[model samples]
Target: MPQNIYLEDYTLVQPHSNFVIAGGRVFIKKWTSLSFNCTIVTGNHKPTVGLNQRIIERLHINDIEKDVVIGEDCWVGANVTILSGTMLGRGSVVGACSLLNKSSPPYAVLVGTPAKIVGVKFSLEQILKHESNLYPEHERMSRDELEVLFEKYYKGLKSMGTDYLSPEEKMKSMQYANMQYKI
Candidate 1:
């Protein structure tokens, strides 16, 4: 029942779900939502061992200082587990039932058990610029202002692109493609 969960620039719905988040800054950029049943645990994983002694001394679990930053315009699927020291970049999508053990780069889509980068959301320059704008210290702008900026840079890309299917749709398409696998 820990409250005061630090959520910045991130949207979280289905609040009744149980989860623990500690000692890490959670930056939820614009349009990013953390769905129900998601657990973000931020604590030290380093186990301390005493030298020259067979017994283990006090385990020094450092104050897991790294912030869990979820970039802007991203969707975090349900039942997602984000471990300590994880950084998810902007415009990224994390599929459900995924375990994030490592920091993810900007504009990268991650999925599966070990959470591999399945897709790239944007170029390095774009990501860097977006990060600079999204930094907390910078002057905060309205959502409309951000949208206008995005449109200016990404309108052409959006128009030229086809509609991106949801994870469920993609799964169904895959199943359909493999006719050998019966429903």
Candidate 2:
């Protein structure tokens, strides 16, 4: 972890998820989840060209500021390297072992080196609506409560022939349903 690294309203689970970010920015939006072994580095690679020329000046620049912005309700898989200025949009999924070098569009599933959009997670409207409710904190629910909540929401989704829910909406709904059952 580095100074001024912002992980706003997100959840990071797993032991010892270390990062080396020098003068870099990391923004994890609301309800997003970052799994184990995720690293973001701001240092540029060693310059291979001549040191005197202005064209090679960028090569010697060691302290390049790289910012990583992960949007709302995103699921970042384990061992992911989010490079400088990489923006993953709302409701997107980054697959495991991927290197994100560019900005991803909202709701897109991205994977691979120089990650490409593999699929869409959900419609923008659905993401916005659903994420308004669910969040990672719902994992705090007791086993029995979680079971009941899952059964209720997942069953409803199955009936509707849908397979996904935004992280925040899903968690909040579960927590709400659990509370209802308790009373």
Candidate 3:
């Protein structure tokens, strides 16, 4: 993997999954959950004209490479496939057996074969109202507090640069991973 890639701790990428981060840059924000049989592809082989030539034999076979970014507080269900050039916004939820090949809005809930936005987990007003609970009200991080934490984390992910992972992104990622949520 390149130095630009960042994988926050406590990210539950289950077994039998492939995160092809070596081919290109991939920035997975904190507290993201990827279930079993998920595949994140950042590169794809281009079409060749010759019929007889094998993939290995063809020299200079063009390859399209693009960055795959997963925002914070996102949950990718089992058998999900995230293709190259896909940018998932923060606090997004992807249903199981979905194929995500395009960008999504923040707090969107996507499901289906091509992964269309079905609904939002939380309305914009609801999210903003719970923002204050992000800080530790009493150290336990009640349910309301957790929601605030997720929103804060999402903001950090939203601001990640094309270069290195920002401090806010890292802090949000690692912080939520240590919370009460199980992988």
Model with the higher lDDT, candidate 2 or 3: 3
What's the number of clashes in each of the models?
2, 4, 1
lDDT per residue (tens digit) for residues 22-83 in model 1: 45555555557777787776655444454322222233244454566666567778888887
Best first by lDDT, ranked: 3, 2, 1
What's model 3's lDDT at 181? 40
lDDT per residue for candidate 3 within 1-183, as digits (tens), equals 446467875456788888765357778876688889999888776766764346623442566778999987689999999999999986689999999999986677788989987766664445453333332334222455445645654433332112245899867767765453444
Structure candidate 3, residue pairs in collision: 30-173
Per-residue lDDT tens digits for candidate 2, residues 9-48, read 4355455455666667678876678888887765555454
Q: How do all the candidates rank in terms of TM-score, highest first?
A: 3, 2, 1
Q: What's the true lDDT of residue 150 in model 2? A: 38
Instruction: Give the range of the ten consecutive residues with the poorest summed lDDT in model 3.
Output: 154-163
Off-target runs (Cα >4 Å) in candidate 1 are 1-4, 16-19, 49-63, 121-183
lDDT, candidate 3, at 22: 37
Stretches of candidate 2 exceeding 4 Å from the true structure: 46-62, 128-173, 176-183
